[model samples]
Target: MTVTSAASEPGDRRGAFLLLGAIILVWGINWPVMKVGLGSIPPFWFGGLRLLLGSISLFLVAAFRGRLTLPALADWPVVATVGLVQMAGFLALVNIALLHVPAGRSAVLCYTTPLWVAPGAALFLGETLSRRKLAGLALGLAGLLILFEPGSFDWSNRPLLLGNAFLLGAALLWALTILHIRGHRWHGSALDLAPWQQLTGALPLLAVAFLVEGGPDAIDWKWSTLLVLAYNGPIASGFAYWAAVAVTRRLPALTSSLAFLAVPVMGLTASAVALGEHPQPALLLGFLLILIGLVLVEYKPRKPAA
Candidate 1:
């Protein structure tokens, strides 16, 4: 995936930074929230329900912000790409993969989308990959390796292997979405397009959920379950997705992607606290490398020629 901004440098770096932080927090915590949810709900149903809630909440928020509108015809391709590939395809695979893989591992694997995006951006979008950015990418990937703790990932187990494969597939879809987003000529704010994208993704998600999981009778909707589902909805999916799109649009793709590496670290820490899955000592080093990488990636971004 490419790290270049296909558009001009964002005028509002502060706002984009804040939104990026929000996205990281919501999605990082969602790792464990989802782990808990899947214990009681089937994967397909759980994914669909959460996305449906996301779409409704997003529409309300967009309307409240006076940004709600039908997507422009030019934006429809982006909408479909993000909605179907990023939201539905990625979430569905992640949810199913989470059934077999640990949440921390899943986060680490799925966030590897940047590895594919960096080269892609240079090739397809003509974004320059500076030496600093490339180094940051390498260090960040190293951190991911440490967090993943490859030795522990049971390559021999069929289910676990397949789950890992699913995560990589999700990452690919996400990379494609990112590339499309960077290259797209937007006619509206991320807020304006967010609800439509959610609606697009939600339709297929719900349809697939109904087909695969049958009726929702299998769901055990206890108080804990309801809370988990709610967190996954408006907070994690709707708001996080909106914020993520905003961040991607505003920041250098490399900068945003490297910063996003922080999510799995947060997820790892959160998983430890929420799920009682303690991190290995090596993961502490991984955390340091990732942050350093983020700093390096954002260091001295080139200014446009006057």
Candidate 2:
């Protein structure tokens, strides 16, 4: 569990909360950062390069802690699942969607993964589907409906529609990744395996970048552009990933879920501040509905007669 002692023993509950807060901040702001990066590079290249730097940063972290090692043979499947689906596919698609979608709104759409994950968990993980969960699902879908309401969304706008589709797809992919991670018995701590997964995810992405964007020539290389790119790597992806895993290993699940929900909220706020994105009334209402649903979903009722 060297996630490196994972350093995440229960005694460090305060530390875990601190890390969770950091994760929310970094990941939330990251939405606008990715959107900004797209201005300087094509989506695929932007995603690939950012991911590559993140992987390298992770590798360095593992090495510096003397915890660096190849993934355990048994861990490779989970690594590939996480790397390809969550790290590579989900992120790549999200970046592409940012090319068309506004950052704040896209943040709302992309975070719908938990709504999908609840049902999938019940079916696949043999978890109980409680009444609260059902209610949560209903409310979450209501939110989605509001966002997609005819009066609000211009479905006639193809690029916007496509961008929303991509974000939803990314959410689904992330849910699938989490389901797989849940089903798989772990042979290594998340920290130990994470760097390898990053590399596994990054290599194919760079290949795609090569074929699609054709080289480094397209990158803007401006100061603001490079600054965000650097931020995406070490701070957002690397440290955030590490901190999240460590916090997950330490904190109560419900606490983690409730805390993590701040990500989209922060994303919306950051988008407004950084990208000048003002939320429409419908979008804001939809966002509120989704947050309430998530709170319900993470609420665990008592076990009957246990």
| Top candidate when judged by TM-score against the true structure | 2
| Whole-model alpha-carbon lDDT for candidate 1 | 0.79
* Per-model TM-score versus the true fold: 0.82, 0.94
- In model 1, the worst 10-residue window by lDDT is 1-10
Question: What lDDT tens digits, residue by residue, belong to model 1 across residues 8-84?
Answer: 35569999999988878888999998998999988878877887888899899878877778988998988898888
Clashing pairs in 1: 1-116, 1-117, 1-118, 2-117, 2-121, 3-254
Off by over 4 Å in 1: 1-22, 140-153, 242-260, 282-306
Instruction: Quote the positional error of residue 218 for candidate 1 in Å.
Output: 2.3
Q: Tens-digit lDDT track for model 2 on 117-221?
A: 899999999988899999999999899889767676787899888888999999999888888887887887787887788778888888898898888887888
